[model samples]
Target: MAKHCVCLTLDFDTFSVWSAMGQNSPTPISRGEFGVVAAARLLKLFDVHALPTTWFVPGITLDTYSAVCADIHAAGHEIGHHGYDHISPAGMSRGDEIDQLRRGIEAITRVSGMEPRGYRSPAWDLSENSIEILLGEGFVYDSSMMGHDYLPYRARTGDRVVSGQLPKFGEPSALWELPISWSADDFPHFEYFRGSGLARADDVLANWLGDYDYMTKYLESGVMTYTLHPFVIGRGHRMIMLDRLLHELKDRGAEFLTAEAAVARWAAL
Candidate 1:
């Protein structure tokens, strides 16, 4: 039988996102607070469907919302590293990035009682040193790149790129790459930020389902990851849409897996 896997991954950044962007005003801070409300709703929805998902949580969020983070862990969901304060590694010094990684991992361990096996960069941007850092820290996978849509591959490091030259590809490392795309993420599709308009739920749903359909039809076995934020997808209409999407995916024989589990399966093959 053809296996079509789906990983429902949530980035539980909370107020850390605003802090990272230097937008700690009341309005922006409140926007982050809304994620708490959305997370509860999503947890309930996941319970109703008995779905297993992964949450990429920042260190600040974990420290500030220990109970919520604990609740997520107790509910049998995987918690992955997302940075210390939603800071993107792309702009950080290698030392700072590593410090962020260490601090984030320590916070996650404190809350979940286990080290994270996966890491997803904040803002979906990884520094050139990201792969080496993840490997050194013993992370099994990273989900911040878009090398392929439906396939998981080993991550590469040390690629050479220039303004007007054919890029030199690096050799694959031991770390796995469970790629993500903006198309499958909720912030760009639903959040009205800096003039980006909210898309109709139906339109986004159609596109999401179409991707799954294509994967089911063409790939022997594949993983489709959908990225969602609590504050964005927890809205009434979007929550309903999410529930419906889960039902539809279940009906189509989509095997839901946590990001860590998905990466393990990919590595085994």
Candidate 2:
């Protein structure tokens, strides 16, 4: 039988993302605060379904909302590193990147009493030093790059990409890459940013379910990851859609696995 795996991943950035963008105004801060409420709803949903998921949390979020983070861990979800303040890795110096990784890991360890085995770069942009830092820090997987849709691959380091030359591919490292895309991410679809209006949940559901349908029919074995943010997907309509999506996938025989578990299976292969 063909195997189809689904990883439901949440980036619990909360106010850190707005702070990193220098938007410390009351409105944005309050908007992020909604994540706490949303997380509770999501946790109840997961409990009802008995599904395991992954949460990529920033250090600031862990510090500011320690109890909420603890609740998530208590629910038996995997918590992964998501930087110190939701700052994009691509804009940081090597030292700053390393600092973010270490500080984020320490915060996670404090709450979960264990190091995160996976890292997902803030804003899905990886710096030149990200892969090396992840490897040195003993991270086994990353879920930021968009190199593939349904297959986990090795992360590469030191590729030379110039203005007008063929890209020099670098050697693959021990770190596995559980790729993600904007298409499967909730922020772009459901969140109304500066001017982007909210999308209809039914439409987004079609696209999400379609990806899994294709994976189940065509691939011999694969994993599809859907990225969600509590502030975005925690809304009433979207939450209902999420529940329906899970039911649909279950009826279709999709195997639910946390990103850490999915990556381990890939590594074993």
Candidate 3:
């Protein structure tokens, strides 16, 4: 039997992302705080379906909302490391990046009592040493890169790209890269970050389901991943659409799994 998976990833950012972006005033904070409310709604939906998901949370979010995060663990969802302050590591020094990684891991351990084996960057950005740092910290997979749509592969460590020179590919590291795409992410489609938000809910749902159908029709066995934010998709219409999407996926024989679980199954194969 062909095994097809649908990994629903939630970036449970809460107020951390807004705070990191210098939008910590009341209005923006309120906007981010809505995620907490939306998270409750999402958890209800997932509970109704008994679906497992991966939630990438920052240290600040965990520390601030330890109780809710504990509920996520109690519901059997995986809490993956995002960052300490919801800051991107693309410009950080080696030590700073390591600190962010360690802090996030420590927070996760404190909240869930389980060491995280997966990581996804805040802005899908990473410094040159990110893979090395993640390996050193014992991360099994990363979902920050966009190397593939549905296939999970090992993350690369070092690549040489010089001006006016052929690009050199780097050696693959031990960290599994469960690749992601902005196309499949709900932030750009739904969040009004920069004049590009609020697409028709049905339209976006069609596009998401179409991608899954494409995968099942073509690949023998594959993974279909969708990245969403509670604040973005937890709206009334979007939530309805999300529920319908999950049902349709279930009817189509989609097996839902956390990002980490999918990687483990693939690795075992």
lDDT for every model?
A: 0.94, 0.94, 0.93
Q: Compared with the true structure, what per-residue lDDT tens digits does model 2 show for residues 1-269? A: 23679999999999888989999999999889999899999999999999999999999999999999999999999999999989999989899999999999999999999999999999999988899989999999999999999999999999899888999989998889999999999999888888884999999999999999898788888999999999999999999999999999989877889999999988888
Q: What is the lDDT of residue 47 in candidate 3?
A: 99
Note each model's CA RMSD in angstroms: 0.9, 1.0, 0.9
Q: Tell me the tens digit of each residue's lDDT in model 3 across 138-188.
A: 999999999888899988879877899999989999889998999899999
> Local error of candidate 1 at 46, Å?
0.3
Report the lDDT of model 3 for residue 238.
Answer: 98
Question: What TM value does model 2 have?
Answer: 0.98
Residue pairs that clash (backbone atoms under 3 angstroms), model 3:
none
Candidate 3 residues lying further than 4 Å off, grouped into runs, are none
- Tell me how many clashing residue pairs each candidate has: 0, 0, 0
Which residue window of length 10 is worst by lDDT in model 2? 1-10
Tens digit per residue, CA lDDT, model 1, 118-146: 99999999989999999999999999999
